[model samples]
Each structure stands twice: as C-alpha cells, then as structure tokens.
Target: MKMSEAFATTIAGVAPVILLVAAVEIGNRKEALREGYHLIGQRQRLIDELYAAPEAPTGLQLQAVAAQTDQPMQSATRDLFIALYVMSALIVGVLLLLAESLALVWLAGSQRGSHPLQAAFCLLALVIGFAWVMLAPMLGLVVAVADDAVVVISGVSRLRRFYRDLDTHDRQQQAADGEQT
Candidate 1:
C-alpha cells in the first residue's frame, strides 16, 4: 500500500476507535461508582435508624446489614479512573495500529526484489504514524499533514537506498567474475 494509505489507516484505527471506546467506558465507570457511593450512604442512614429505634427491623435484615458492614469498598478518584481508561485505550489502539499496518502491507502485494529492509521500514513508519495519530489534533492540520508525509517520504528514500545497494552488489559480482575469467 502507499505510505499515506497505510498511515491513514493507522490513524483511523488509533484515534477514533480508541477515543470512542475510552469515553464510553469512562462514563459507565463514573456512573456505576456514583450509584455505589449512593448505596453506601443509604446503608449508613439505615444503621443510624436502627440504632435510634432498636426495634421493628427483622433479625434477617439486621444480619444482612452486619454482613455488608465490613465489606471492602474499592473505588478510584475521577482522575485515576480517567487515566486508566485512556491508558487502556492507547494500548488497544497500538495493537490495532500494528494489525492494520501489517494487513496493509500484506495487501500491498509483494514485488520482485523488494528490499530485505522492508520490515525495518515498516517499523519506523509505525513509530511516525503513531506519533502523528496521538499529536495530530494538538499539532494542527498542516503540521499533521507534514508529519504524515514524512512516513511516505522516508519510504521512498529507503527504496532508493535498497536499489543502490543492489546495484553495488551486482557490480562487485561482475568484477569478481571478470577476475576469475
């Protein structure tokens, strides 16, 4: 695939997908925690009423309250939960970027004399693509486009270097054959 196409796919998989998932999960967690805290508050009120009256509550109901009294409450601050959600989303996005890029490469179709260093090129491309994906919104459209273009430009240079190396190897082989002759 063309470098732009590959890079675009990487950006797509990372940016939109991760942002969407993270927002949804963070919202869900925040709502759930709010409800849990509400329950805890109601439990405290129930215990206060029981102490004030000491009658009218069933034995089983008191036992149930006692059972839950010492239960550990696990909760995180909003900052902590948001941080975790964003981090988790990033990890998944990185994996998705790798998968999408690899699929793009496979679909690009192999050519005869493709460089041995093609895998290396892909690795570097991914690094740049990832940087662009993460920073694009902050960097503005023009800068992001340049950043994206770098991946494609570097791939071109790599192709040229690979062919140059092949040319040098061919000439050396020819010279060695002449010497033998």
Candidate 2:
C-alpha cells in the first residue's frame, strides 16, 4: 500500500476510539460540574445560616456546614467522575503509545541514512502530528463542557472571594457597633 493510504487507514481505525474517549471525558466534565454546583449551593445555604443571626452561629450550624462540605466529595457521584477521568487518561495513554510505535516503524522502514535532515524533519512532523491528534480532541471536549467554569475550573477562588467579602462586612459591622457603644 502507498504511504498515504496506510496513514489514512490507520487514522480511520483509531478515530472511533478517540471519539469515544472524548465523549466520555465530556460527560465526566458535565457531571462533575453538576456536582460542583450542588456542593456550592449547599455551601451557600450554610453561609446563609451563619449570617442569619446577629450573633455567631452555634455548634449545630457548624456541624451542618461540615456535613454539607464533606457529603459531595464522599458521595458515589464523585467516584464516577474519578473513574471517568482515569478511563479517559488510560485511553489517551494507549493512543500515545500507538502513535509512538507507528512513528518508530515509519522511521525504521524509511531511508533515514540517506538524508539526516529529512529524517529529523520527519521525526519533528510526527511529534507535531501526535500532539495535535492527542490534545486537540481533548481540548475541544473540555471547551464544550466548560459551561460557566470556562475561566475557573474549580471555582474555589469565587468562594474565597465571597468569604473575604463577608469577613470584611462583619469587621465593618463590629467597628460600627463599637463606635456606637
């Protein structure tokens, strides 16, 4: 078979696996985002409880907050997300191994001794091709599933900001109370 024909056939054979892995990764991201939103809602509720009274919350509210924080991470939903990440990572690893083997075979069969520069160029091209194929699909899947978390993956920073704002407000209130007294 011609070189181009072989390349086309090999890619055709691999495309389905790559597509399937990408779909799984996208689904994982979606579910993870859903779970994250649920956890954030729980956290917001806890925060509301803490701010409900003029005085500090009692031990019961603190226990409820701790439970809410731990529930999401400890649940089966998180296990499924972790499993998807592992499976997708394994699929990507297999694809990389296959690409590396193909590159090695192509290098061995081609007349590399005759033109060292051409051989080097071919190796570089193979690396670039592997990177494109390996990363592009995953990147596209990530972008598609990003939703509101496109700029911030974990969203921990947003929570931190909220907490900081609350602290500042509380400090100001304390200062006002002291001044009034």
Which candidate gets the maximum lDDT versus the true structure? 2
Query: What are the root-mean-square deviations of the candidates from the true structure over C-alphas?
Result: 30.1, 13.1
Expressed as tens digits, the lDDT of each residue in 51-160 for candidate 2 is 89899888987887777676554444443544555565565555544554554555456543344443344344444445655775566456445533543555788889
Query: Candidate 2 — what's its lDDT?
Result: 0.57
Instruction: Tell me the number of clashing residue pairs for each predicted model.
Output: 0, 0
TM-score of 2: 0.37
For model 1 the TM-score comes to 0.28
Candidate 1 Cα misplacement greater than 4 A, ranges: 1-5, 48-181
Tens digit of per-residue lDDT, candidate 1, span 1-181: 3444455445445545544554565565566556656756766877887777746778987887777653312222332443444465566556555645554665465543333354445545455545544553333334435555766798899999999999999999999999999
Q: Best TM-score goes to which candidate?
A: 2
Give me the overall lDDT of model 1: 0.55
TM-scores of the candidates are: 0.28, 0.37
